[model samples]
Target: MYGIVLSRRDFREADQVITILTAEEGKREYIARGVKKIVSKNTSHLEPATLISFGIAEGKKEFSYLTNVQPVESFFHLRQSLPTLHIIGYSLDALFTMLKEGEADSDIYQLYISYLRFLNTQEQVRLLLLDAFLIKLFSHLGYHPSLDACVVCEKTYKEIGLEFLSATEQKPGFYFAGGGIICASCKAEKQRIGEVAYPCGIKEINTLRFLLASSWQDVVSFPLDEEEYRLVHKLIYEFMLYHSERKWDDWGKISLIMT
Candidate 1:
């Protein structure tokens, strides 16, 4: 079967255990003996962010082991940029964090493959790609943050009449804990319960709507101002972490307020 390497770590002497994500098997772990040796044939194919075709030996022992592996797409271009590497770091973190082992999710697997290909070829490694993937994945998992209406009052975004760059604390904000956008009126009640809502305005809200509604192809062309993109990106990461029950506990620093 073919899969993308998710992560790996040293096992006993000269051996390592690897985790991979596959469409059929979802996420899995396998032992690759002697993988740390200088003559290891599969060493190069084992790197994280690499796609490889491999055979697994269902050993009599408790763990399945990799029998053979051949390189598929190395995504070599990402190696050239530090920022892109960081982006991939956060992306992979989210993917593995949200995915349950031994569970098949073909849609998310496809999105993962397509996203890597897009990142590999595209020079602009914007957070927009990560944003789109997270939103798309959430939709696949059936957990979109209530983007269209206030989670409290049920007012549509249009009815809220959100304004861009409106700096008043009275403005409606994205309460990650609350699962979506909330109007100013509702924000108070949430604050009374101590849920912090990161302030977001029209552009952030609309951009998120467009992302959640569109395909990856369409999201690539969707125009966004720098600040607007950052705000939405922040919201996506925070929403995922919060709703995923802090599965991505390390995915901290999503702003408490959109600056």
Candidate 2:
């Protein structure tokens, strides 16, 4: 079937090694052999974030080849602004790195398309959109954070200080570690590093909770104040890093692009 071009790497002087998020195959990479030919119309149409219909031939194992492609939604607005183009580019790259090839993830494809469409809008709320996109994307990948109740004690985060274990801290700042909170009581039970709780305000936690719990369509239109928006931006970055277990270089850059 056809899909959107998520990412592309130059394979040669005149060809591109690319990955497409297909409805049938999820994410697949192939050599767009000779796509860069001077007279080839296909090469011009395969930009990142451009929706295109592509025919694929299943191969031996864990790979596929592209037979043909037709443009669908080009997301032309993404090209109008450099900062926007960069943020969306990084988001697409993150997806490319995080998703496995030949896996069927229709949900991810839909979320990605939604994110692209949202980004194409002329709203000055780029950071808000980025934060919302991360929360939705991470939730889909099963790395969603515990933003409501205390992850360790299973108690509602009523108090101002909500501690969580820090994965990489020598004297871990809070009880947050590896996707959950380690309560003060639970902290003593474990021999690992621990630290007292930090103040994670109710509003901050609630915003995260709402983002995780709500649908993208519903959440996209939701608004955020500057402080709340900044909290989400930081939380999602930490959440992605903590959950995915990988360092994303472009994430910080995307945050800066919005600023």
Candidate 3:
């Protein structure tokens, strides 16, 4: 089956356990026996994000072993660039943290493949692609943030009079616990209930809405200034962490790379 190596962990002696995201099987853990040996050809092919085809050997235990790996796309160029490498590492780390073992989702598998392909060719837009991928990944995982209207009141931005908010005006509040942007009215109501919200400027709010609504083709061309990019990155990263309930050590590193 065709798969991407998501992560690898050393096992007893020269063996290791490799977690692979397969096109057909979603995520599967396989034992690669003696792969830690000096002459093992499988070691390099098993690196994270390496795409390959391999056969599964059913073992007496619950897990399976990998055999006959044929490399498809190694994405070697990613290693040559520090920023791209960091993004790849962050992406893989997020995937590894969120994806459950043996859970099959073909859409996510395809999305991952597309992400790698894009990263392989487009170095300039890696950050944008990563952000877009994160948004889409959350959508695929059924945790898509409600960006169109107020999460609490369900009112449109125009109805809430946020569309005309000036740069100097107090920005709309983003209530992470409430799942999305809160209108002025709902923000007041939330305040009465002792729930605090994060302030998000009009530009940042609109940028996020566009991202959630746009395709990768369109998103690639979307213009974002350094400040706008920073806002979007912080919002998305925090949102993912809050919803996923997982703290990633690489978050600061990836943020630094984006800057």
Residue 236 lDDT in candidate 3: 78
The sequence of per-residue lDDT tens digits that candidate 2 reaches over residues 7-50 is 78877687787888876778778777678778877886788889
lDDT tens digits, residue span 1-259, model 1: 9999988999999989898999999998899999999998889999988999999889887899998799999999986776567767777877777788899888888888888887787665555766777787887776867877888778887767643235455577887765788887787787787778777777777788888777666777788776677677777777776667665533224332112
Looking at model 3, the pairs that clash are none
lDDT of 3 by residue, 90-189 (tens): 7898788888888899999998888788777756544766777787788788887777788987888765554435433545778888777887667767
- Residue 234 deviation, candidate 3, in Å? 1.9
Using all chains and alpha carbons, the TM-scores for the candidates as numbered come to 0.83, 0.78, 0.89
RMSD of 2: 5.2
Estimate the TM-score for candidate 1: 0.83
Model 1 lowest lDDT segment of ten: 250-259
Error of 3 at 246 (Å): 2.3
The better candidate by lDDT, 1 or 3, is 3
Query: In model 1, which runs have C-alpha deviations exceeding 4 angstroms?
Result: 162-170, 215-221, 244-259
